[model samples]
Target: MRNTRSVRTHEPSFHQSALMDLRRGGKFAAVFLVLVFGAMGLFLVAALVIAKQSIPDRPAIASPPAEGVGSAPPSGSAAAATGQDHRREQLVRFLTAAAHPGQPAWRTWMPAKADTSSAFVYTPLSPADPGAREAGPGATARVRPSALTPAQTASMLEAVTRRGSVRPSSVAVSHASGRASGWTLDFVVRTSGGNWLEGRAAGSDRASGETVLSQLTYRR
Candidate 1:
C-alpha cells in the first residue's frame, strides 16, 4: 500500500491561535507600555496625596512669662497687646487670690518671675514657729510660720530669693528641729535662677512691732 502523509487539522483553538501570535512584538509592546503608564499614574497620584497631608494647621500655645507683661505697650502691634493682656490677667487672678489681711499689711513685690505677681494676707494663727529648727546651727536662717520678727523674715527672704513681700500666699510652720508641721510651708522659695525669699505677714503685734505670723514663702 502506498503510504500517504496524514492530513493535518487546519482548525486551531482560539487560545492556541492567540498564543502563537504572541511572538510578534508590536502588540506585546503596546500592552506592556499601557500597563507601565497606568502603574506610574497611580504612583504619582498617591505621592501627591501624601505630600498634601504633611503640613501643620494650628498655632502653638504660648508659655507663661511671655514677653510684654506689666511693661509699656509697643507702638502698633496687636500681637504684643494680646500677650500683655493675657499676662496681666494671669497675674491678677493669681495675685488677687493671694492677698494678705494681717496687721503689718505686707505684700509681694518684685516677683522673681517678671511675668507674674503675688499678694497675701495673714493672721497670727500659727501654733508654733516653723523656721526655728532649719534656722538652727548649720542650717540656713529663714522665716518661720510662727510670729516672725520682721527683721528675721526680711533677712531670710533676702538670703533666699533676694526679694521681699510683707504677705505671702502660704505660711512656713516647722518644728524646732527644722521640720515643718501642720501644713508647714517652705518659706524659703527661690526662682529657677534666683535665691529663696522670705515674706512677711499682714498683721503685727503693734506693741511688739513684730509681724504676726500669717503668710510665708512657697511656690504653690
Candidate 2:
C-alpha cells in the first residue's frame, strides 16, 4: 500500500455568515435613510427661499395732516392778495379807532405814532359807486374836489364812527379806484339811526417808510 495523505477543506460556519449579512444590511439601510432625509431638507430650504423671493415688497404709508393745518401754504398772487387784505383790515381798524377816541373798544386799535394832521378830501360819491367816469368832450364841468377842515373831518369821522359802533359787524371796506398813487379804501358803516354812512380813506408811505393818512371822506 502506498502512503496516502488526505487534505480536509473547512467551510465557514452558519452563525458567522448570518452575523456578517446583518452588519452589511444595517450599514446600507443607514446610508439610504441619511440620503433621503438630507435631500428632503435641502428641498424644503430651497422652496422657502424661492417663495420669499417671489413675494413683492410693500410700500410705505403717508401720515395725514394735523387738524386745522393746510396741505400747503398760499403762494404767488394768492399770497400777495392775502397780505393786501390783512393791511386793509388793519387800516379799517385804525380809522375806526381814530374816528372815535372816546370808545374804549377802539382804543386798542390806535397806533402810538399815528398822524392825522394830513389834508383830508371830501367827495359826494357813494362808497358803492364805481370808479369815476372819464370826462366826455361835451360833458359839463365837474365840481372841484373840496378839502375838509380839521374840525369838519373830526366831526364827520365822529358821526361815521358812531354809525359803525352801533353794529360793529356791519362795517366793511373795499378798494377805491381812480387813485394814481397810494391806496384808497372805501368803507360802508350801517347805523341804527338811518341810512348807511359811506366813507373813503387814503394812505401813502412817507420818506421814513411810515404810512400816513392822506385823505378821508364820509357821507350818508
Candidate 3:
C-alpha cells in the first residue's frame, strides 16, 4: 500500500513540472512577438523620415504686379528712342540682305512703305582705284530702276565668295538723321572678305518713319 501511495505522489509532481514548462514557453513566445513588432515599427518610422528628406523643395514662381494704379507711362524721349531703334533694325535687315544675295527676296529688304517713284541715287566706285574714292558731292546720279542690279548683287556677295568666305559678319547703321522729308540712314555691311559695303536708306514720312533703299555703294 505505501509503495502505491508513493507512485501516485511522483506522477502528480511530474504533471506539475510539465505544466510549469508550458507556461514558461508561452511567456517566451509572447516576448519574441513583442520584439519583432517593435523592430518593424522602428523600420517604418525610419523609412518615413528618409522619404521626407529625399523630397526636393520647389522654387516659387513670381507673378507680375497689376498695371496702372501707380505705374508711370513711358516717357516721350523713350518712345522716340524705340522708334529710332525700329528704323535702325530695318536698315540692318537691308544691309544683311545686301551682303548675302540668297534667301529673303532682295526687294523685301526695302521698308514696307518705300516710295518707289523716288529713284535711288547710286554712285559707282571708279574701277581703277575702287577703294580710293571718297564720299564726294556730284558723285551720285538718280537711277530709274532703283532695284539692285545683278552686278550689284554679285558685288554684295563678293565677301561671301572670297577666301575664308562666311555670311555677313556684321551689319551696323553708320549714320542716321531725321529730316522734314523722312529719316535717312547709312549702313555699313562687313563681310567675310574683310570688306564693307556702304548703303544709304531713306524713309518717306518724317513723323511715322518708313525707310527704303535709296542708295547702295561698294568697292570692287
Output the number of the lDDT-best candidate.
3
Per-model CA lDDT versus the true structure:
0.39, 0.53, 0.56
What is the descending TM-score order?
Answer: 3, 2, 1
What's the C-alpha lDDT at position 10 in model 1? 91
Tens-digit per-residue lDDT, 32-83, candidate 3: 9999999999999999999999999898887777876447867877765665
Ranking by lDDT: 3, 2, 1
Better of 1 and 3 by lDDT: 3
Deviation of model 1 at 106, angstroms: 10
Per-residue error (Å), model 2, residue 188: 2.2
TM-score of every candidate relative to the true structure: 0.27, 0.37, 0.42
Clashes of 3: 0
lDDT of 2 at 16: 90
Instruction: After superposing candidate 1 on the true structure, give the runs of residues whose Cα lies further than 4 Å from its correct spot.
Output: 1-23, 58-220
What TM-score would candidate 3 get against the native? 0.42
Model 2 lDDT on a 0 to 1 scale? 0.53
TM-score of candidate 1 on Cα atoms, chains taken together: 0.27
